[model samples]
Structures are given as structure tokens and as C-alpha cells.
Target: SIPDELQLQILELCDMTTLAAICRTNKEWYAKASPIIWSDIDFVELSGDGAYDDGLIDQQRQFFATCSTRMDERPDFWAALAARVQSLKLTRMPGIAISYKSKAELNDSNDYIFIEIWPRDRRNIYDVIAEFKNLHTLYLFVKDWWEFSSIGESEKAVAHNLEKLTNLKVGGQINQDMMLALLSRPENIQHLSLINLIHSPGQDNGPNPVLFLRSIQKRFTNLKTLHMSKLAELTEDTNITGARWEFDPAAEIDLLEEWADFLRHVSATL
Candidate 1:
């Protein structure tokens, strides 16, 4: 009965689109009859409107940032909510402004000021994601190229910091450098889905980037899944050793087989 009332209150406060994520907290919650909240909000349509200008995104980001900054201030609040959250879906449009306040306390040399930025830049986004440490599933729906690049900026941090994350769905260009950085981390990530990875044409005579990823597949023992879609740079002679190994076929075979075995296992699971 209490959960019913709490669910109703949640329905009133949360965006209707987010109800699916809320109900996924547990089986019991999903079994209880309730309207799908998202149908009521028309999120796909209204999301393009100025929802952030009315102080929704700022309020939530600030709330979560404070909870993360001060462990003692709201320990119970953060701990309890972390249990309920399983999937987090994020969408960013150009010109959406988010405000930031450092939770660090006052000191003689310390300065306190509010920072504001649009979520269309890579470097700024890293600062924004420092708050969400417990996220497991992240889905992004980017509308434009700028939005796409911004998501790529934060993907590295998401893979490294969110050690609990198993699923990541991105609709953007995932560069080889970012992928390598993610694979280098010693986290328990098992699933990686990159959609529409467009190859930027350049005269890069260095080691082929895809070979670098294959190398990482050999090195990262826990990687279980990789889906590379719409990649345009597939070539047969992309060399990993480039002049380092002197084109040694035996060494290449060993490395390639190691990576192939890992990918084969991941493919079977998927």
C-alpha cells in the first residue's frame, strides 16, 4: 500500500517516459497495475522543446551532484536510490544549459562559483558525468553531429568509472582512441554496442586503429561482447605492428588468434 502511494507520487514527479525505468526496480513493482507514464508525457515530442529552461535538468543534476559530493550529507538518500536504479537513458539537444555548483566547503583560498555550459562539448561533459558513479545501463539518442561528438567525449569516462555498467548503447561516431582507452581499463564491462561508427578519412600511416582494438580484445580478458556497425574503414592489410614487429607472420597469427577466440566467445553469447 505504501509502495502504491509512493509509486503514484513518483508518477506525479517523474517524467512519464522514465516510468519504465522506475518500474524495472523489481518484479513486484512491475506486476502492480499502473499506466505507462511515458505515454502521458509525449517525451519524444516535448523533449525537443525547452524542458531544461523550466529548471528540470538543472535541478536533477544538482541534486545528484550534491549527493555524490557530500557522502555524509545524504548517505541514505544516495544508497537507497542506487538500489532502485538499473537503467538510465540520456538525450542531449543543442542549447540545453546545465548549471553546476562545487560542493566543496569554504576555505580562505577556495572559491565558490556556479558554472554553466551547454551539453554539446566533450571536455565539459566529463565534468557533468562525475556525479553518476553507480550507473549500470546507459542509452543515448543524439539528434545532431554535435550531440553525437559530446556523447563520444563522455564514453571513455563511463567505461572507466562506472565499473558496474554492462550495457552501453550509443548512436554516434565512436573513435578508435576512445575505444582503446575504454578497453585498457580493468572494469567488469561485458557488453559494448557502437552504432554508426563513421571512419574519418585521413592520411594516418600509423598502426591501424582496428588492429589496436583487436589487440585490446586479446588483452582485456573480461570483454564479452562487441558490435561494430556501419564502420566504413574495413581493410585487409591494416597492420598492427607497422614496423615494430618487422611483419612477423608468427607473432601476428598468435595475436590475431587470441583476439579471434575472445570475439568468438562473445559472439556466441550474443
Candidate 2:
């Protein structure tokens, strides 16, 4: 029989399915393969048609629930497992619309139909994030604007504690304050991608893309790649009949100078 160290090295080379199979075989293999399997937790929604998996959705829900339960029951074991997680991909399940109904409207049986299914628990997503001590790469696909803001509001300190975080990819509606709060503390962020970032023009002039670029330029010295797309602004116009707000594309000429400056600043790292 091979040495345990050699077995672990061999297990590391196996694919997820193969490792999972190995875990089911015996207790020793389970102990060896489990940590490697949990190292990268991917619940990211796959692109294109028929990519959504119902089983995966159920698993994600169960994961959150289990974390809440296990942390209370076996705090030491859960802490160790959480620490093993290095990469995490969090996204909403396709086709399952998140209902934002009040808690009174949701019964226990139908709570799963809504995104607020875990409200009863004290631990929100940010709490779960704080547990992953070794997290380096995080991919978060935020479906709602409030959810994006909530991250900044709830766990302002958690982002700062994520010293190992370097690669971050976020999508959905992001405002100026929320964006700044999210990016302010993650000093080691090297690769950043923001997709479908909706900029709402408020009293503070909304999401100033150029300003954000400048902030990024100042904050991250190790920054290499910065990718942003669908940078549109939402403006409220009382003049428009029946519609209060209108979507407008951000002016390219306005950001050209700042973009150039940012490019020059990060050119060495890039």
C-alpha cells in the first residue's frame, strides 16, 4: 500500500467526481479527500441554456443550513472545514426567481421559494464569508441591488480581514457607496471584474466610474487587471411620461482621461 502522504498527493490530482467517489469508499480516503474537495466551493451559475442544476440549488441551500447547524453543534469541525475553503463562487440559481415578500407572507413550507429563506438564522452571507480564513478568490453574482448594499452595511470589517483575498468578480446593481465599501478594505485584490454594474444617479452624483477608477488606482498597488462592463446610469426624469427613471449609457469621452491615467498607473503591474 502506498504511504498516506503519497495517497493524498494522488487524490489531489483526481477530478471532483473521482475524489467524491474515493471519499465514499472508505473512512481513511474520506479523511484524505474531503479537505481537497471542499477547498474550492463553486455554486456559480453556468452560462447558456439548460446550464442550471436543481440538485446544485438544493445543495447550496443545504450548505448554508448545514453551516448554521454544524457551527452550533460542532464549532471546531466547522471552523476547520471553513478554513480549508480557498476559492468560493456564489451565484443565484437560474429560473428560480427570488421573491422579496415580507416574512409574514411566507409560510415555512414555501420559504424556499424566496431568497430570504435563511433570515431566521443570525448568520448572513457575510458571516459565512468571515469564516473562510484562507479565502483567496471570490466570485459573487448579486441578483438584487439591496443584496449588494447589504454586504457593505453588514460586514464592513469582514472585507478588511480577508487579507488573502486577491481575485474578486462581482456582478449586478452596485452604487457608489456600496462599491467603495466593498473595494475599500481588500488591499490585496489583484484581479477585479465588475459586470452589469448599474449606476444610479442620486444626490451624490451616483456611481462615478472615473472616481471609482481613481480610487482603485490609489488603493491597489498590486492591481493587474480591471474589467468592467455594462456601466450604465439610471436617472430619474419627471418629464418622461409614465416612467420615473430612465437608463442611459455612460459617456465614453468623460471617462477617457481617467481611464488613461489608470492605465498608466497600473501599466507595470498589468
Best by TM-score: 2
The C-alpha stretches of model 2 lying farther than 4 A from their native spots are 2-6, 15-18, 44-50, 93-114, 117-122, 145-153, 174-178, 185-187, 199-213, 231-246, 250-261
Clashing residue pairs for model 1: 16-37, 16-38
Clashing pairs in 2: none
What lDDT tens digits, residue by residue, belong to model 1 across residues 27-120?
Answer: 7655442243321322233356534332333334453355445444676665554444455555432222233443232112312122233344
Local distance difference test, candidate 2: 0.60
The 10 consecutive residues of candidate 2 with the worst lDDT sum are 93-102
* Model 1, runs deviating above 4 Å: 1-86, 92-123, 141-160, 181-187, 199-212, 219-227, 231-265
Candidate 1, overall lDDT? 0.44
Instruction: Give each model's clash number.
Output: 2, 0
Q: RMSD to native for every prediction?
A: 12.4, 6.3
* Model 2 Cα lDDT, one tens digit per residue, 32-53: 8899888977666332243545
